[model samples]
Target: MKSLPRLSPTSYALLGLLARGPATAYELNNIMQTSMLRVFWPRADSHIYSEPKKLLSHGLVSEEKEKVKGRDRTNFTITAAGRDALAAWLAEPDAATHRNQAEFMLKVILAEGGSPDDIKATLARALETTRTETRMAIAGIQHIIDSPEAGVRKGMPWNGMAANLMADILIARLRWAEYATEAAAAVPDDSDRAAKEDIGLAAYQRALQRLQAELDP
Candidate 1:
């Protein structure tokens, strides 16, 4: 099979969502607003509308036109080429460059220049958002556990695992936000490069420990 041209992570995101089902640009904007997409890897709605043309250039997706009450209605569909590309992506290692968009680097990068108060405020806003997400994720898991989907009605068998994964991710992010908030608050404005290196090193060690614990076999 001819290799489909590589697409941006955002383009891949659009194609992957389309693979689930045909959607209008408006519907996709709604999807982007609710999930982790809404937070870490947020894409503007305009990008969603534009990527389809690029996907079309690469033979990845198609658009269909309909009329709703005398208005033009355009819906996008993933093509066979798109499905093939998505499958190839899923089979590869997820340790890709796209992971850095998570915004955690803001704490370390913006350690200086801005007023400490401003840095604190930026982090506070992000922390509050993550905390709310953490709560929503917890509530969703509770709702699922209190009544299994299969037991309740016609529902997916493997969906519980997906929900659990989401809950675990949000919990991890919440813990990170909590820790970063404190760490950022601890460092003073006049700290020199050496001191900031120490902070970065300490964070790296902690992350290493966490990874080791998770990967213990």
Candidate 2:
């Protein structure tokens, strides 16, 4: 049996989208831009435009061409092999212990190099973004519940579950940002290293307590 090509997470993400239905790359890019994929698995438009061709080369997806307005449009659909590959990827165990939030967290970690206002602004932006995302996620769930047709409703159990997870993470981030923003604002300009360490220790303790509570039955 021929081995499947080693695919990146982005490749699998595209395959998952194709599994839903046939779509032109433009349609897929729009979906990525406007849907939960934007929040969960964002990619650059250039990458989105090009990945379909790679999937086609790997025989994971098939392209159908048609003429619209005398212009060639290509639609991609996942092949049987694509479905098998996706299933296999899903079945593989995820070794990651935590979700990566390096982009924002890195700023948080290195905030001492900047002023307290800088960190506060970072936290404020995170808070706002996560709040918006949380609202969008809830709205998405409500849409799925209220949709008349089965097309949007077809995702059912899995989609709902995934949305719930997304909302949970967003809410967690929102809460963290709120707390961090408040704490950063409270920091005194004259605070010495020991004072800052004390503040950080307190924050760590609070987090530990929260984690312990969560772990409790």
Candidate 3:
């Protein structure tokens, strides 16, 4: 009946993963690298290691220490309170925001002095990376959606829905990356703000349309 303390989204991510089962920080990192990283790209391993302790302090999760190959390992499991809190958070509107602001701003700043060719190369690499990550994410999500256990989870279709959304977002990102690759080449060395804005706006509108189509009810 107590109100859950407002915590960072990272805390809920840890709790949600633990709701499935107990996991050491290492295992959580592996899970993130495999799946969660597609959705929450910027979290570091250090944050994973530290977050469970915060949840434990709040009585949302409990931890136990074990000896693993002569070293100590701490594994965390969600408490009932954690499950309740996670459910409550999920029912609220998602507060997650895109992580591209600083990178995009830096690109704009660098366009003032950096060579167009260099910028093109950077976006080219990003496009390739997005392609690779999106492919892997689709495969992973499809695997989950195909699994029989997916329906038996408490969250059921929402987990499947979230996976579907991730795939859609990645596809949208791929579109934007492709557009960015072309626009980077077209950008003039003078850093024409209007031209850059036009390029970005076009890419954004395309991506938004794709996402909106997926979420249309």
Off by over 4 Å in 1: 1-3, 36-41, 91-98, 102-104, 136-165, 180-217
Give residue 142's error in model 3 in angstroms: 4.4
lDDT, model 3:
0.75
Q: Which pairs, if any, clash in model 1?
A: none
lDDT of each: 0.74, 0.85, 0.75
Two-way lDDT contest, 1 vs 3, winner: 3
lDDT of 1 by residue, 85-145 (tens): 9888868776654354645456547647667787777777778988888787667556656
Q: Give the Å shift of residue 144 in candidate 2.
A: 1.8
Instruction: Evaluate model 1: give its lDDT.
Output: 0.74
Q: What TM-score goes with each of the models?
A: 0.65, 0.89, 0.73
Model 3 scores a TM of 0.73
- Model 2 lDDT per residue over 1-217, tens place: 8898999888888888888889999998988887777767778899889999999999999999999999999989999999999999988998856445448889999988998778888888888878877777778778878887877875567877777667777877887888888888889988999998999899899989989998994
Sliding window of 10 residues with minimal summed lDDT for model 1: 148-157
Best by lDDT: 2
